[model samples]
Target: MVVAVVAAGGPGPLINGFGVDTSCLGYDAHNVAQGDADNTSHNILHTHSNKSRQSSPGKNFPLQNNSIALEIMVNVPKERKTYCAGKCKKHAVHKVTQYKAGKASNFAQGKRRYDSKQMGFGGQTKPVFHKKAKTTRKIVLRLECKKCKTKKQLCLKRTKHFELGQKAAASGHQY
Candidate 1:
């Protein structure tokens, strides 16, 4: 989800909303001098929101206060059409799978240090995170080229319910 801080006047520059800056593109000294900055600023923001919505089409990120909530699609298909780095000349069909993290090795420096600290009979050596804010994790798609067998990963937006390969019974359904 995108984190946006709203000021008393209007939505300030986005702290981090898909790494996009929410600052009004039409802002300039001329507009402010003519006293038309406020009027044009909101229009520019609406234009930016339209472009963002069109770029993804699936995810509707909020840019202005009017567009506060929008449904997010979390279902992914088994196959995807993405650029292949290996043998394909251009965009080609690829096999899509959910990316999974491998198990961490016990011999890692952090693991070893944690083990030693626990053996010394300390109740809690490290600070445990309690105030969890985010409720969803970003979904990663592992794409493999059909011809060259090349693999690439793509990170997607965070969603409460994520599905891979099969369609979910209810996801962003307008009903």
Candidate 2:
């Protein structure tokens, strides 16, 4: 009697012999390397390696488990446009010149109209004073792109309106 073992989707029988029982062969047990066995499955053939597989040309590969995808924004230059304080325009306003009204006060007058107790002059006559004239300043606006050496004027305001280091005129150009 001839016995044959046929494999599923296989071209030929796995084993065939005359005068033999196919049931005696049983199932072929797979051997795996150390740490190759799957913890959830007892079957040796179901074990998988921990190493990641690299992609080869002309091969369809599935995404790996625990992979993260990211979206990035790219800046492209077309017709250069400018964004102003609250409006967008075809040509950006190079400079916004702000003319502030001059402040007039007598605080700067050096005239000593009154003497304090700390001055030690209880009844001395007040000394004559001279006031320094206030001066005006001109600020230039500038904007530049770090990647490209392109620059343009932005906006300008009186120096008095800004604090030290807080002045937009003296602030470095932002890309």
The candidate that wins on lDDT is 1
What value of lDDT does candidate 2 attain over all alpha carbons?
A: 0.35
Residues 110-155, candidate 1: write the lDDT tens digits: 9999889888664998888899887667778999999889998998
Query: In terms of TM-score, how similar is model 2 to the real structure?
Result: 0.17
**123, model 1: CA deviation in Å?**
2.2
Cα lDDT, model 1, residue 111? 95
TM-score of 1: 0.54
Error of 2 at 167 (Å): 10
Residue 30 in model 2: lDDT = 22
RMSD of each: 15.1, 23.8
* Deviation from native of the Cα of residue 147 in model 1, angstroms: 0.9
Question: Alpha carbon lDDT of residue 34, candidate 2?
Answer: 22
